[model samples]
Target: MRLLQKNKPVIRFLLTFFGSYLILAFLYNLYLNNASSQKYYPEFITHIVALQSQDLIEAFGYETKSIPSDYDPSMRIAVNGDYVVRIVEGCNAISVMVLFLAFILAFKKDWKSTLLYIFAGLVIIYALNILRIALLTIAIYEYPEYTDLLHTTLFPAFIYGVVFILWFIWIRNFRPKTSPKDV
Candidate 1:
């Protein structure tokens, strides 16, 4: 009893974090499952991501086209008529956003601030993901030999690194709103 009481804050935080994560993850899964049934659903988010990434690639004077993949339910982003990178549902970044949201909610601050932070962080993450995909496309196009390293390692690391930094910022700034004197 004493031990639990001593660690009440930590326990509460862990429970809240996991509880919210499960709920959000379940809801996201439900959305995906339902979406999978619709003919146009698969292209909805991933296609948009592909289009945005294509736009970024083209901005640098590279010819690119984002189209639906005939082989799979993914968006095929073709660059320079040779290099193609498929953007699947998993590449849309929704799962990572959900994790970020769960953590931010678990350590929520004032309502207005929390909402604003979530919105801003989500925008940053989404934009960064687009950039990551674009960069990966360019790298693969330029050096086909390093496709595995770029896709499997560097890109994932970039997204996770951004998430880690965002989590650190949230934890530092919005730390439960407890009073300094409470310590």
Candidate 2:
């Protein structure tokens, strides 16, 4: 009891963090599973990514089109029409968003600030993901030999790296502060 009382704040923080994270993760899994039952990929996000990818590719002067894969409607992408790179639900970044949300919530700040930061962060993540997909589509089109390296290494690193930076910023600048006495 003495030990617990001494570390009450830390204990409370951990409980809140892990509890919220698990709940959110479970909810996201439920959403994904439900969507999967209906389609191979979540239509909403994947479709948008496909469309955006196509637009980016076209803007770059590459002939591109986004279409449902012959294998599944849920699977789609902007392709050169020959080397098709399907954008599935996993590529949509919703899971990553959920994780980011969980971390932000765990180290909470003022309600208004928290909400605004979350919104801004989400927007940045989504836009970066779109850019990542666009670049990846071009890379795959131009260098099929580096497909595995691009998809598995470079792009994931970019998104997760950005996410790590965002988390660092949140902790450094946005997380609630404590007085020297409190520490």
Candidate 3:
């Protein structure tokens, strides 16, 4: 009880922050899921994937095709004429949320650090996500057996690890110092 009382401000801040995020996420998901039969999410993800594909095709030596189907709600990318890559929208959201949380946790008490961290984090995440999609597209073309493992384990770990490293850098270089007396 005493500990809770002592940490009341911290607890309040956390509760308010998380509560607002959850409410907003829920509302957004609800709007995307129910507002239309097309499910704003899949198309939005497809657009992002298409843009990534265009960049990859321009930068790398790969060609991609878009197939329209009602079979699954995922972005499909074909590479080199034969291989197919299916990227689900949920996975993209998960990766993005991980990056967002990393920035939030890293810059919790400082607005300046928070703004810079968020901008850097978003750029990193966007670039990484494009690379991730491109790699997965290539992987599906080369090794089908490794697709599940890479998608389920390797990619998430790699991206999150990068975010963690960035958070550490932000803390070491940017976080404001507080004296013991302040605590």
Top lDDT prediction, candidate number: 1
Candidate 2 per-residue C-alpha lDDT over 1-183 given as tens digits, one digit per residue, 9 for 90 to 100: 988987776887788778877898898777765654334234666777778877887888888876666676555554556755888877888778888887888788899999999999999999999889889988987898999999999999999998999999999998899877656
C-alpha positional error of residue 152 in candidate 1 after TM-score superposition, expressed in Å: 1.2
The list of candidate 3 runs beyond 4 A from truth reads 8-13, 34-41, 98-106
Which lDDT tens digits does candidate 3 get at residues 25-140? 77667755754335443656555655565467546777776453457776556676763766666546444554465446534767766776777777787677778777767776
lDDT of 1 by residue, 115-180 (tens): 999999999999999999999999999999999999999999999999999999988877676666
Rank by TM-score (best first): 1, 2, 3
Q: Residue 115 deviation, candidate 1, in Å?
A: 1.2
Considering summed lDDT, which 10 consecutive residues are worst modelled in model 2? 33-42
Best by TM-score: 1
TM-score against truth, every candidate:
0.91, 0.87, 0.77
Q: In candidate 1, which residue ranges exceed 4 Å CA deviation?
A: 37-41, 177-183
* Model 2 residue 146 CA deviation in Å: 0.9
